[model samples]
Target chain A: MGSLQRLGRWTLGVLERLGRGHLFLLRTLLAMGTLVRRPGLLLREIYSVGVLSLLIVAVSGLFVGMVLGYQGYITLVDFGAAEALGTVVALSLVRELGPVVTALLFAGRAGSALTAEIGLMKTTEQLSSMEMMAVDPYKRVIAPRFLAGVISMPLLAAIFSAVGVAGGYFIGVGVLGVDSGAYWSQMQASVDFHEDIMNGVIKSMVFGVVAAWIAVFEGYDATPTSEGVSRATTRTVVHTALAILALDFILTGLMFGDI
Target chain B: MTTRRIEITVGIFVALGLAALFMLAVQVSNLGEYRGGDGYEVHAYFNNIGGLKVRAPVTMAGVRVGRVTAITYDAERYQARVSFTISARYDQLPTDTQASIYTAGLLGEQYIALEPGGEDEVLRDGDVILFTQSALVLEELIGRVLVNLTGN
Candidate 1:
């Protein structure tokens, strides 16, 4: 009886939090009206969230591409289809890995940072003080950060995919002795603009909105305490990762199911 | 001072991201392909299209001249009708051109190959290639071989 009661309580708690999170998101989005007037605020958050996260995303992209090149060469060579190394690498990166991996990394880097920052503000009573000063903290504080995240995500994913493609090119053509002409020509022939590349860009944009939403919501909803701040930060990372993966599955099905 | 630095860094970051997208579109994908919008449509009817798909390259003498645009079934003629577009530059192709579906590599994608014939008449928009060969299905080939062996 007690176990069943605990399960019911947990379900209700989750439902309540989910409802509250959606309300917070709606409010934050509504508060974005002031964004155009204060572009500097949005730019500053973009600098922190997007610019700061570029290094990890690029370096990881390069390594991932190189590894794919090496592994793809090993397997494709067995089939005597080593000429398709570029197509394999580019397709995989743009279609699946680019947005998905970049979002995972962004969750760890920017998502956690946003949560911790907002949680800290709440913990230190800064948000409360802002409330006292007749300033809507959601407009002044949270909206720009959330907007920065949404804006940065697709750009970051694009950078990752481009760098990854370069890395794959270097490893496949330079190190693995694949023909440079075949490498590029095959990729161009097979990778369609609307089907593969644009689909990836659309995917990254969706992921961006989602990652930013979860980050800000978690931070805004955090309990005003030191431990609560830490816990919220952890939750931001975990939730963002799971959300990205789940959304990736759904997006891939909808986008590429015909292929 | 820090604000200026932040603005500059953000500017550079935005530029880099845009540049990356440009590269993906131009270099990685087929967005840079010459889409002159000066192409003429041609149709061909085949016994079997096999794995032929829309947007498959239409090659002439080993050079890509166009792409397959539409694939449909001809209920009246009991054939697979394929519609493709050839760039205006290749407008001199003879009306007697033969269209055949061929696979690249062993297990690669299928494409339509055009073999030019000696004719004064040029293929215009909406003209159908009368000579068409279907894609070679491996299963049918094996079945034929088995029948011949058993009969022998």
Candidate 2:
């Protein structure tokens, strides 16, 4: 009977947290309505979140693509299908790897930072002081960061895919002696703009919304203490990574499945 | 950072992202090719299509001129009907053009090859080619060879 009571209490606690999270989301979204009037704040946040993370995203994308190209060439050469290396690389990057990897990297880079920043603000009573000064912290702080994250995601994903494709070309044609013309021509013949590229963009956008929402929510919901801030930051990263992966599977099925 | 510096940096980032997308669309995919409309379609019937897929190239004399648009069964005629669109630039094909399915290399994809005949009348929209050759079936050829060998 004691164990049953504990289980019941745990479920209710979870439900209560879920309800508060949803309310926080609603309030943040409403606060975002005034965003057009203060584009400067959003721009600053974009610089911190998106532009600052560009180097890591591009470098990682390059290595990933080069590895794919080298591996693909070796396997395909055995089958005398080396001409298909470009098609294989481009399709995989544009359809699956580009958006998914970018989202994971973004969560690690920007999502955790956003959570930590907001959590620190709370721990220091900055948010409470802003409220005392008749300032709505949601509009002033949370909304800009949230909007910045949401807007930066798709752009970063596009850059990653493009750089990755270049990296693949470098390894496939430059290092492996694959015919340059065949490399690009085959990829052009196979990859469809509307089907693959647009779907990837849509996927990144969805991941951005989810990652930003979770980060901001965890920070706002964190207990006002240093330990609480650290916990919230850790949760933000773990939850965002898991959510991006799970959502990628569901999005891929919906986008690609004939059924 | 100063507001001016942040604004410029963000602007450059956005520009870079857009340029990357442009490269993906134009260089990495066939976005430049006019896929549909602005072209006339012709029909042909085949006994066997054999791995032919939609969007497969439709070539004339080894040069691509169009794309396969649809493949369906003509139950009334007991044949496979294929419809393809020829770019407006290649609208002067003879009405008696011969259409045959050909595979690229031994294991490559299947595509339609059209050979223009000596007819003065050019093929028009909705026109059907009278001479249609079916795709070669390797298994059937092997079966025929086996039958000949055993019989001999």
Candidate 3:
């Protein structure tokens, strides 16, 4: 019985610490200075986060569009609103699907890599060595990562939305035999500059920032061991995914309500 | 460095992507450059314009000659006020144009179609379109059709 209570206490402490860890990261960011001194690092990190991962995002986006189109077309046909298939695809993809799916893909691809890399660096005392050498690790590491994420996330989302919308068209018109001219026209009419693309672009940049920050924070704090790195990597993906989804919901509410 | 190559590649991708988007955008326009400025404007008032989105095309004799331009519902008047842009080239409608809510098909979107009344007077941009049709929802239409067919 004593052992059970002790075990429960220990579990509670660990959970409490885990909950508090994000606040520690937030504090670290608030204390972070010298972001301006690290232009080169920022540019490089942006490439890694934004550019290297395009192929994966694009492929996923294309398939999502096709599937969304397939679903919307059949559903609209049942109600005789078959002409509305294009608008439905465009509205849903740009407003909701694009930012989310792309962020999830980023979590799988980049978030895990960031966590593992940071965890390994922590274990090796390499970050300490950099600190001892008077190198500002935040400037060299975190700033660039944050900047890169901000840059790349929107581009990735745009690619996702466009591919998805086009996929809808190909599947909806070519495969489903809807008139291509009418399909395109409805899509054009349904979307406006404010409601669709602009909102998506803004949401994506926010997701990028949150996802990268969580991944890096988890990794930077991990202990110096293989197990630590593995755990950090898994946590990075999970946390990033959750943050992206949560942020998506909040931003969608704010953006649409204003518009 | 390898990073430079990545940036250049990404730049190209972004440029190409934007170009593709621009091309698609151009293709999606009304391109109805065929401005037949001979049609008269029509107005409608509805107690409720539920699901009656703007830009829904107005059809006559199974042909689309104009599109809905705007929708404004006056709460005080207890009416949904809508305006449609007709080509000026079509025959001028009399002041007593009868407009009604229409469906594209069984499950189609709701539109406001105008049936010309022989009032010997034509409808202009601000004319109060007489005898308007409100939208016919699919479920309601279906229920009616089914009930009639059942011979009940």
Candidate 4:
């Protein structure tokens, strides 16, 4: 009886989480409603997500590019095609790596905070006060973070991509004795301004919206207690990371027309 | 009063920015000038491109001046024909300039690399580059090297 009841409870838990996800989507749409009426929130989001996160995006991107160069050159050398290393690094970073890695970073750094902040308010009965005061928390809180994450994630992603390319170049041309002039020329030619860059930015924007929505939903719907707030924050970060990765695969297939 | 929210958010952005700066420095320095040098567009024929794709680099004397723009097979020729757009600066190539397929690293992509010829007359645009070396496939090269070493 105990084990059966436990299994039943597990099933219920899965369904509950799914239901919460749907509610989050609904609320996200609701929050986005304020985009036109109050555009200031969008600016705040760009500042918070884009400007603030540039450092991590840059450093991580550089190292990623460097490693790509270091590794790519070696593999190509064995194949007697060492000159193609730049293309490999740039394409991979633009098409997939940059957006996904930045999303994970954003989730770890900001997603949890959003969830906790909202959850804390929920536990403190502050959310109730906001509602009582005729303040739509969705507009005041969720919308800002959602738009900010959307705006900022792409900007940071671009920074990451640019940095990563530089990193690869440093290792390839500086250390590996690759011709600097040619290296740059090849990379420039390979990187299509519209196709590669646009794809990544678009992915980042979508990821931002999804991440912000997940975090906010966790916070706003959190139980009225301290433990609930903590749980909400943790859940938001983990779920956001997972969702970002899943979205990456889907978007890649969609954009590339992959079967 | 400083809110924890503001503090965490600010810290996150600052950290990300620093990383971005480092990455930018690497990319800019590595790529050098993006403009193509004075050179000629050349096509190479191959049985298999072998990991070669569009936008691959084209190198001469170990210096890159162009990239592979397209890869297609001429049914009549029965070989993979790769088109490379080289720069205008690298225009001086003997009619005997050889286009060899090379790679940056093992498991890396294919690139059409050029070797200048001793001839005085330069190859013109849309001219079929005659002296050519096909890509050395990794497996084939290794297999041959090992066989030579083993006297098999």
Candidate 5:
């Protein structure tokens, strides 16, 4: 009976936390209107989130593309369909890997950083001090970061896909000796803008919103201590990764389930 | 100031992102393929379209000369009407061109392959190619093969 009571209490605690997170996201979204008044702050956050994340995103994209090319070439050669390597690589990256992988990297890199930065500010009493000074921290701090994340995600995903395609070309055509013209022509013939690429963009944007929401909410609600900040940052990464994967599945189903 | 430098870098970053998006739209997708002035349309009717889709390439002797623009059901004739536009550079195809839907590679997309016949007249806009071969249904072929195997 005591253990059953403990289980009930644990479930209630999780529900409460989830409710708080939802409220925090709602408030942050409402505060986003103030971002237009301070474009410079938003741009700075974009630099920190988007530009700083570019190196890792690009490098990973290139390597992923190369691996895809090498693997796809080997598999396709067995069936004498080596010419379809480009279509395989391009479709896989643009439709599935590009947005999903970019979002995962963004969660690990930028999301954790945002959580840590905000948690540390909270621990240092900066957020509270700003509130005392008549500055809404939600508007000045969280909104711009969230807006920047949403704007940067699709761009980062696009760059990842582009670099990935180039890397695939380098390995598939240059190394594996697949016909270069066939690679590109087949890809162009198969991939549709509204069907494949735009769906990826929409996916990245959704992941951006969910990831940024989790990061800021965790940081803002963190206990004002060193250990608390670290815990919140870790939670931000874990939660963002899970959310991105789940959202990817749902988005894929909605986008391609019919066809 | 550092602020101006950061802004410039961000601008460049955003510009690069936009360029990548444009490349995806134009090079990867079919956005830049249909500019309207460089092609002329021709029509054909088939008993079955199979997996043929709009934007499927129209090739002549292994060269892409056009693309399928539209597909519609002709209820009156119980056939599928396919419209395609050939580029002006490849506009010299004879009026007797036979349009056959052929699959690219095994388990790949189906495309219209134009086999030009011996004729002096050239196909023009809105002209219909009277001869056409419908796409082969793999399932039907496999079923026929299975029936033959069972009967033997």
Candidate 6:
């Protein structure tokens, strides 16, 4: 009886949390209706979130591409298919790794920061003070950040994929001696813009929304204490990471399963 | 001044991102290759397609000129019929050009390879190449080798 009661309580707690999350998402979306009136706020958030995340995304993308190129060269050489290194590296990065890795990094860097900033504001009574004023904090604060995330994610992913392809070219052609022309031509032949690149963009956009949502929501719901803010920041990273991965699998299956 | 700087920076960022996307679209995909009405289709029949798939490249003399558009099994003839589009730029392929299925690199994907003949006639849309070779089955070759060795 005790165990069963505990299980019931746990289930109720999960459901309550889920309900609150849904409500938060709806309110944020509704607030987005008025975003055009305050473009400056959105732009500022974009600079903070998007520009701030750029260096890490580019560095990681380059290294990841180099590794893929080297590994792909080793494997393809064994089969006398060293020329196909371009297609293998480009397809892997553009379709799967670029968007997913960028999102993961975004979650770690930007998502956690957003959560901490907002949670700190909440703990310090800044958010309540805004409420005491005539300003709607959800409209002024959360919605712009959310919009910035969604807009920035796909762009960041594109940069990552492009840099990654260049990195692959550097290692594959320069280091491994794979024919440079063949590498590019084979890649051009195999990958499709509509099928691979567009799908990856869609995935990053969805990830951006989900990660930003979790970060903002957690901060809003944090208990008014330092420990509470810290916990919310941690939760933002963990939840955003899990959500991005899970969404990637589902989106990949939906986009590429038939082919 | 600060606002202008932020706007300019963000504009540059978005521009760079869009430029990257355009490069991916043009350089990595078929969008740049097959603009509408720029290619012609021809069909070839083979006894087996092996692992041949749609969108596989069709090459002549190690240069890509087309892609396999469709693959269908003809139950009556026990053959696979492949339809492919050759770029309009390469429309001068001789009518007697022979189509053969060849594995690209060892253990790699299969593609249709064309061997041009000396005939002066050029192939047109709906034309069928008469001379063709099917995919070589590795399993069958191994089985035949095993049988020959054991029997001998």
Best by DockQ: 1
Best by lDDT: 1
Candidate 3 structure quality by residue, lDDT tens digits, B40-147: 666778766668777787766656667787899688888889888787766566777677777656545787666767788776766777576666555787999999
lDDT of 6: 0.90
lDDT tens per residue, model 6, A18-83 = 999999999999999778987998998898899889899999999999999999999989878888
Q: DockQ for each candidate?
A: 0.88, 0.87, 0.23, 0.14, 0.68, 0.72
lDDT against the true structure, per candidate, is 0.94, 0.92, 0.75, 0.76, 0.91, 0.90
TM-scores for every predicted model: 0.97, 0.96, 0.73, 0.65, 0.88, 0.91
State the lDDT of candidate 4 residue by residue for A167-194, as single tens digits.
8888998899887766765565566655
Model 3 TM-score is 0.73
Which has the better TM-score: candidate 3, or candidate 4?
Answer: 3
Candidate 5 Cα errors over 4 Å, as ranges = B37-43, B69-76, B83-97, B115-129, B137-152
For model 6, the DockQ equals 0.72
Residue B110, model 3: Cα distance from true site in angstroms: 2.0
* Model 6, C-alpha of A141: deviation from truth (Å): 1.0
Best by TM-score: 1
Off by over 4 Å in 4: A1-5, A253-259, B1-152
True contacts kept of 2: 0.83
Of models 1 and 3, which has the larger lDDT?
A: 1
For candidate 2, lDDT tens digit of each residue in B71-143? 9999999999999999888988998999999999899999999999999999999999999999999999999
- Which segments of model 2 are wrong by more than 4 Å? B35-37
Can you list the residue pairs that collide in candidate 2? none
Superior candidate under lDDT, 2 versus 5: 2
For each model, chain A TM-score? 0.98, 0.97, 0.86, 0.89, 0.98, 0.98
Candidate 2 matches the true fold with a TM-score of: 0.96
lDDT of 1 at A119: 88
